[model samples]
Target: MKTLLSTNLIYSIMAKEAFVKEAADDILRLTEWIREVFEDGGKLLIFGNGGSAADAQHLAAEFVNRFLINRRPLPALALTTDTSILTSIANDFSYDLVFVKQIQALGKPEDLALGISTSGNSVNVVKAMETARAIGMKTVAFTGGTTRPGGDLAAVCDLVLNVPSDSTPHIQETHLWLEHVICEIVEKQMFGTT
Candidate 1:
C-alpha cells in the first residue's frame, strides 16, 4: 500500500508537469483573455458541476476578492454560488437550462464565460458555452483532456485548458494550480504588481 501510494504521488506530479509543459502557451493566452476582460470592465461568469463546481467558486472568489495582491477587486462571479437561483432554475427550466438561463440574463458580449469540467463532457456546461457563443460572450473551459466523440466541450469554447490526466483529483489539483497562475499573471498585468 505504501509503495502504491508513493508511485501514485509521483505519477500525479509527472502528469501535471507534462500538462504544464505542453500547455504553457495556452495558459498564457488564457491569462491575456482574463486581463482583457478585466481591462474592458467586463465581469466573468463561471460554472461547473461536482468538483469542478468547487473550482468555479474557489477561482471566482480569488478574482472578485484577491488572489495574492491588494488591489481593487476584479469582477468575477461563479454561477454556482447562489443556491436559491440554482434550485429555482433547476425546478423551473430543468437542470440543462440552469446556466444557460442565467447567461442569457446577465451575460454580455464583453463578459467572459468560463466553464469547468474534468471530462469535458458535461451537457449543461457545454450548453452554456454554446449559449455564450451565440451571445458573443467569450468562452473558456478548464477540462481534463477529452477524446470522446462529439462530447468535447473544448470544441465550443474560445479557449480550453485541458489538463493532461484522467484522475479527477489530480486534474482538479492541476486546475487549481492553473487558476492561481492565471490570477497572478492577471494581477500583474492589470495592477502592475509582482
Candidate 2:
C-alpha cells in the first residue's frame, strides 16, 4: 500500500510538471485574449459543470466583484448562478439547452463566452459556445488535454486554452490558477495599477 501511494504521488507530480512545461505559452495567449475583450468593452460570460461550474462562478466573481486588487466592477456573468434560470430552462427545454437559451437571450456581438470543461467536452457548454458563435460573440474554452466529444469547442473558439494534463484534479487546480492570473491581468489593464 505504501509503495502504491508513493507511485501515485510520483505520477501526479510528473503529470503536473509536464503540464506546466507545455502550457506556459498558451496561458500567456489566454491572458492576452482576455485583455483584448475587456479593452473592447465586451462582457464576459462563463459556465461549466460540477467543479468546473464552481470555477466558473469563482472566476466571474473575481471580475464582477474584485480580484487581488481593488477596482471598479467589471462586466462578467456566471451562468451557473440563478438557480431559477437553470432549473426553468432545464425543465422546459432540456439540460443541453440551458446555456444555449441564455446565450441567445443575453449574448451580444461584443461579448465573450468562456466555457470550462476538464474533459474538453460538455454538451451544454458546447451548445452555448455554438450559440455564442452564431451571435458573433467571441468564444474561449478552458479544457483538459484529452480529446472528448466537446473537444471541438476548442477548435471553434477564438481562443482555446487547454491545460496540458489529463488528470481531472490537476487540470482543475491549474484552471483555477489560470483564471486568477487572467483576472489579475484584466484588473490591472482595466483599472490601472489595481
Candidate 3:
C-alpha cells in the first residue's frame, strides 16, 4: 500500500516537472493571450468531455468569479454546464456537434475557445475548435503528450498546453493545477496585484 501511494506520487511529480520545463513558455504565452482577450472585451468559452468537462467548468468559474484575489468577474463560460443545451445538441444533431453548435452561435472573432482533452483527440473538442477557427476565435487546448503531442487538438489550437504524461490521472491532475496557475496569473495581472 505504501509503495503504491509513493509510486503514484512520484509519477505525478515527475510528470508535472517535465511539463513545467517544457510548457512554461507556452503557459506564459497563453496567459498573455487571455489578458489580451479580456482587455479587448472578448469572452472565453471552454469545453471538453467527461473529466475534462469538469475541468473546463472549473477553469471557467475561476475566470468568471475569482482566482486568488478580489476583482470584477471576467467574462467566461463553460459550454459543458448547460444540461439542456448539451442534451439537445447531442440528441438533435450529434454528440460531435454539441460544442460545434455552441461555438457557431456564441463564438466571435474577438473571443477565445479553450478545449480540454486528455487524449487530445476528442471528436467534439476538435470539431468545436475547428468551428472556432473558422469564426476567427483564438483556440487553445490542454492535453497529454501521449497522443502525438496533443493529437488533432494541438493542430487546431493557437497554444497547446500538452502535459508530458500518458497517464490519464496524472494528466488530469496536472491540467487542474495548470488551469489554476493560469487563473492566478491572469487574475493578478489584470487586477494589478502582481
Candidate 4:
C-alpha cells in the first residue's frame, strides 16, 4: 500500500513538472489575458463536467472571493454552481446546451469563457466554447492528452492549455495547481499586492 501510494505521488509530481515546461508560455498568456479581461470590466464565465465542474467552481470562487491578496472581489461566475439553470437547460434543450444557454444569457463580448474537461471532449463544454466564440468572446480550454490532443474542445478555443498526461487524475491535479497559481498572480497584478 505504501509503495503504491508513493508511486502515485511520484507520477503525479513528474507529470506536473513535465507539463510545466511546455505550458509556461501559455500560462503566462492566460494570466495576462485574464488581467486584461478584469481591467476592461469583463467577467469570467467558467464551466465543465464532473470533476471538471468542481474545478470550474473552485477556480471561479478563487477569483470572485480572493486567492492571496485581500482586495475587492473580482467578477467571475461558475456556470456549474446553479443547479436550477443547469437542470432547466438540460431538460428543455439538451444536456449539451447547459453551458451554452448560460453563455447566451450572461456572456458579453468582453467576457471570457473557460471550459475544463480532462478528456478534452465534453460535449457541453465544447458547445459552450463554440458559442462563446460565435458571440465574439474569447474562450479557453483546460484539457489532457487524449486520442487527439485536446480533442474537439481545443479546436474551438482561442487558447488551449493541454496537460501532457492522459491520466485524468494527474491532469486534474495539475489543473488545480495552475488554477491556484492563476488566482495568485491575477490578484497580485490587479491589486498591486504581493
* Clash-forming residue pairs, model 2: none
Task: Please give the RMSD to the true structure for each candidate, in Å.
Answer: 1.6, 2.5, 1.0, 0.9
TM-score of each: 0.94, 0.87, 0.97, 0.97
Candidate 2 residues 33-139, lDDT tens each? Answer: 67777778888899999999999999989988889788778888999998999999999889998899989989999889999988877889988998999999989
List the candidate numbers ranked by lDDT, top first.
3, 4, 1, 2
The models' CA-based lDDT, in order, is 0.87, 0.83, 0.93, 0.91
Which candidate, 1 or 2, has the higher lDDT? Answer: 1
Candidate 2 vs candidate 4, TM-score winner: 4
Number of the candidate with higher TM-score, 1 or 4: 4
Per-model clash counts, in order, read 0, 0, 0, 0
Q: What tens-digit string does per-residue lDDT give for candidate 4 at 1-194?
A: 99999999998998789888888999989999999999999999999999999999999889888888778888999999889998988888899999999999999999999999998989999999999999999999999984687889878999999888988899999999999999988887888875
Which TM-score value belongs to model 4? Answer: 0.97
By TM-score, how accurate is candidate 1? Answer: 0.94
User: Which portions of model 2 miss their true places by more than 4 Å?
Assistant: 1-16, 147-150
